[model samples]
Target: MHRPLPTFRVNGAAIRTIRMSAGLSTSETAERAGISRRYLNHLENGYRDRMRPGRYAALRTALGLNPDDQRLLARLPHEEPD
Candidate 1:
């Protein structure tokens, strides 16, 4: 059987804050991150508590997250350590 992707529980508020500060709309951010806007909204609104690591990294990169911002994300709990 195919294994399920691991997920990381992230801070939705922090992600939303960074995205807004970067002046990116959900649609734009999602596009940049190669994900759906609805999924991004779900993440930002905490409707979804966790995301796959690749998606998380893509979101971070799309938001242009800095070291400090990365630190903020480092507090996340993951299914597996990186």
Candidate 2:
């Protein structure tokens, strides 16, 4: 049996706040996170509410989130494997 994929519910506003506080631009953060700027923009604008666990972790790392902030932003759930 395949393991379920980890899904994360992200907080767009919180991400934008953290990025702005860190003095990082969308392009910079996206580059650091290895995601496209448009995708990051979608995330920041709340267009996308769900993300894979790996992507969420990369975004958190790119934003340099503190432990508390990371915990606040991360909500992971498992999805059944196809």
Candidate 3:
């Protein structure tokens, strides 16, 4: 059985939540995330299944999330410490 990549989400609840909350255009986020606009689009639409750490770092920083929030976002389905 193949496991889904931690970054690839069927529903994209996390990605969409961050994007919406930041009020950033897809193009803007893509640039900040250090990915192509198309890649970011795919990630946002749940069309792609993986995001690299570099992209993750950029996105987290651009969104102004703290280290903990970034970890939570990076972990996805995994729960963080209370």
Candidate 4:
């Protein structure tokens, strides 16, 4: 049997925590991350589960995540579709 590819999930709580700790408003964060405010809201609210790699990289860079934060973000659990 062929193994399924691992799909990574976005940890909204982590993103929200980082945004709050950085004292950034949703608009500010979204602008810095090069994404729309609506999308950011979805991510922060846990409505969205996955993100493109480029977007993820932009988000990480925008948030100025440290090594630990990056690791935590990477470790977020993902759900595999049936």
Candidate 5:
């Protein structure tokens, strides 16, 4: 059977964490990442799916995230450990 494609369900907490680490306002980050402030807010609120790849790359890069973080952001959020 074909393998399933990985989902893109970035957790809002992760987004907020990275943003805070970078000491960036949502508007500033959104502008730098080439996304709208409204869209970024939605992403941070966990109400959106599938961020634009370029924009996602921009956010991760601007946040100074390493490869693992980049990889993690590209996939769906993990379930809480049971």
Candidate 6:
């Protein structure tokens, strides 16, 4: 069954939590995710809400998110775009 993509949300806190749990620093995660450190920092600090779809996919891959984790993230409340 094809699952519809969940409503887009800004779960920066969740991302930061997961990153910390994985023992990766912002720089490390950014490098691994093929994104800039500044961008990662913005996400972690909740300065930014939405990232490009490609970047979001890269982040999920970089974070090594399991299926359940992915679901949890999907369900997080959406943030208003700035």
The candidate that achieves the highest TM-score relative to the unseen native structure: 2
For residues 3-30, could you state the per-residue lDDT of candidate 2 as single tens digits? 9787777778878888899999999999
Task: Give the alpha carbon lDDT tens digit for every residue of 1-82 in model 5.
Answer: 9986544556677888878877999999888877888988888887785665566677777667764675325343474544
Per residue, candidate 1 scores C-alpha lDDT tens digits across 1-82 of 9998888777788888888888999999999999999998888788986888788888888988743455325263553368
CA lDDT, every prediction?
0.80, 0.81, 0.64, 0.77, 0.71, 0.75
Rank order (by TM-score, best first): 2, 1, 4, 6, 5, 3
Task: Compute the lDDT of residue 51 as modeled in candidate 4.
Answer: 81
Off by over 4 Å in 5: 1-7, 71-80
Show where candidate 2 strays beyond 4 Å: 1-4, 66-68, 71-82
Candidate 3 per-residue lDDT over residues 40-64, each given as its tens digit = 6776676875665666667677667
Worst ten-residue run, lDDT, model 3?
70-79
Question: What's the residue-level lDDT of 82 in candidate 4?
Answer: 46
| Candidate 1 positional error at 5, Å | 3.4
| lDDT, candidate 6, 9-44, per-residue tens | 547888998888889999999999999999988887
- Candidate 3 vs candidate 6: which has greater lDDT? 6
State in Å the error of residue 69, model 1.
4.4
Per-model TM against the reference: 0.75, 0.76, 0.64, 0.73, 0.70, 0.71
C-alpha RMSD values across all candidates: 5.1, 6.8, 5.3, 5.9, 4.3, 7.0
**Residues 1-82 of candidate 4: C-alpha lDDT, one tens digit per residue:** 9986554567788888888898998899899989999998998887886787778878888888853455325352353234
List runs of model 3 lying over 4 Å from the truth. 1-11, 70-82
